[model samples]
Target: MNNVMGIALSGMRVAQQGVQVAAHNVANLATPDAQRLQLKRSAVEQGGVQASVTPAGVDAAAQLGDLLAAKAEVVAFAANATVIRRQDQMLGSLLDREA
Candidate 1:
């Protein structure tokens, strides 16, 4: 149960980082020599995931793709949040039953 919560939280964090990277890339699209940013994600050894920001190409097409990917990440973040909310509700119900 706790593991599930941890995983969901990590997922949300990764999605957030992805969005931030995408936004940075899109925001600097018109700036000359502005290095694009990318999010590098990896699974944690114990559980969950991690993300890092890295430099990428300044292609307009790739930046658009990043925006689309950011949209997907928003959906992923919402789904993870839903999981956490449901888990909390279930735990509350369990406690209510015990009482």
Candidate 2:
């Protein structure tokens, strides 16, 4: 059951990360330097999955390291979903303006 718990925990953690990266992207939508932060995930060989966030233009690494620190993760959880949504709106607006 421990392994199952680990898997569950990992899944939750990864989902949270996804929401977080999106939030970051949204938060920076107005920032000229922001390039859409994206969250990357990799399956753990043994139990669960791991997640990391990087710029949209970055190449996907086949692996995820200890990139997200504990404090960062907490903040990410706080605003990730909202950030991503905002970013999406901003992107759409920019595209519409161009069109």
Which prediction has the highest lDDT against the true structure? 1
Q: In candidate 1, what are the lDDT values of residues 2-99, reduced to their tens digit?
A: 99899999999999998998888778777888888889899998799999998885564896698798899999999999999999999999999999
What C-alpha RMSD separates each model from the true structure?
Answer: 1.3, 17.5
Query: Candidate 1: worst 10 consecutive residues by lDDT?
Result: 55-64
CA lDDT of each prediction against the hidden true structure: 0.90, 0.61
Q: List TM-score per model, in order.
A: 0.92, 0.53
The stretch of ten residues in a row with the least summed lDDT in candidate 2 is 61-70
Count the clashes in each prediction. Answer: 0, 5
For candidate 2, lDDT tens digit of each residue in 1-99? 346556656766776776566566556555767576667789999967788877676434411322343345656444545554565677789889999
Model 2 regions lying over 4 Å from their true place: 58-99
* TM-score of model number 2: 0.53
Give lDDT: candidate 1, residue 94: 95
